[model samples]
Target: MDQFRSFDQLRTNELSVLRHGFFKLWFELTDGQFCYGKLSYGNFWKTIYILEVEKKTWIIKRKGIFKRSFLINDLDGMNLGVVTPEIWSRKIRLSMNNGFEAVYLNKKLISRTFTLTNDQFGDILNIRTELWGFKKPFKISFDLDMLKKIPELPLLALLGVNLVLIKQAKAANAAS
Candidate 1:
């Protein structure tokens, strides 16, 4: 993967995701290209594998007796961060050793929390993240040629975070 441009450099306002269901999704770019991924669930573990080009790579996974959290790891298997769900609050929190922390909330009709960081490159819920959510659905399509150019980690972050969000939401809905 290429060195990521700062969060400020990417035109995040142009990013969009089309969730096919709870397990399948497509991340669409402003130029009409898409990165796709799938969520695999098991009794004691869950994993998300995203196809950056033609190869499916493990982005994040949750495994154990409780399965309360997910771990993000690099290609070398070094832990990059952790994403845990606040079951009672129905929130997904991503925390990294490097001081990045974010809280994701449920999607609303007009205010879908898609992506974007605050001025300090902080969490999406912070007051400084401009509108802090999507104004409308992104145009959905696929162009495989564009996938190689898309930075991988950012897309991983998008897929993993939203996967956690969707799981929490579904669990909350089921509880009710």
Candidate 2:
């Protein structure tokens, strides 16, 4: 699959993360669709398990507790590959099984990137991958006019962003 076209929908007018309770988060599309995830502890240490809103499918399994590393899978539970953070370079690199490398550029102001699937590209969230003042919640923006669609790519992209932010928070906490 072409890297560029695979994640063309990652950016749009409507994507937001809503907190239902502590550790219970839902990816809310302005069109009333929802994708949900829960933060858990176990063999994976800190694992993020995501469910697509439409089919209630577990599309993402992020298994890195002490670091921002993940092996993202597809619908059939096959490994798509991993996303590792290059903090020194301010980028998240997605390494796919087919030897496709896509970069998610992380900057203080704006960060943008894409994820890949087997046949086609998928969801994109228009978000800034940075945390603000202490104790402030993270924020994401979605194109409200885009309408509702499948939740696979959005969930993938969201999981990737969460991993990056969580790693940054951990580092900061460790430093202090």
Per candidate, the number of residue pairs that clash is: 0, 10
Best by lDDT: 2
Tens digits of per-residue lDDT for model 2, 58-165 = 444455557667776666888767878776676667676766555555434443333222223332344543354222234455443323443244454455545545
Per-residue lDDT, model 1, residue 20, is: 48
RMSD of 2: 8.0
Candidate 1 collision pairs: none
Candidate 1 least-lDDT 10 residues: 123-132
Q: Supply candidate 2's per-residue lDDT for 121.
A: 30
lDDT of all predictions: 0.44, 0.47
Please report how far candidate 1 places residue 66 from its true position, in Å: 2.5
- Candidate 2 overall lDDT versus native: 0.47
Model 2: CA > 4 A from native:
1-12, 23-44, 56-68, 97-101, 109-125, 129-152
Per-residue lDDT value at 112 in model 1 = 32
| Tens-place lDDT digits, model 1, residues 45-157 | 23454323223244566645569787766556677678787878745666766765665554453443433232343333211112333432332222233234333434444
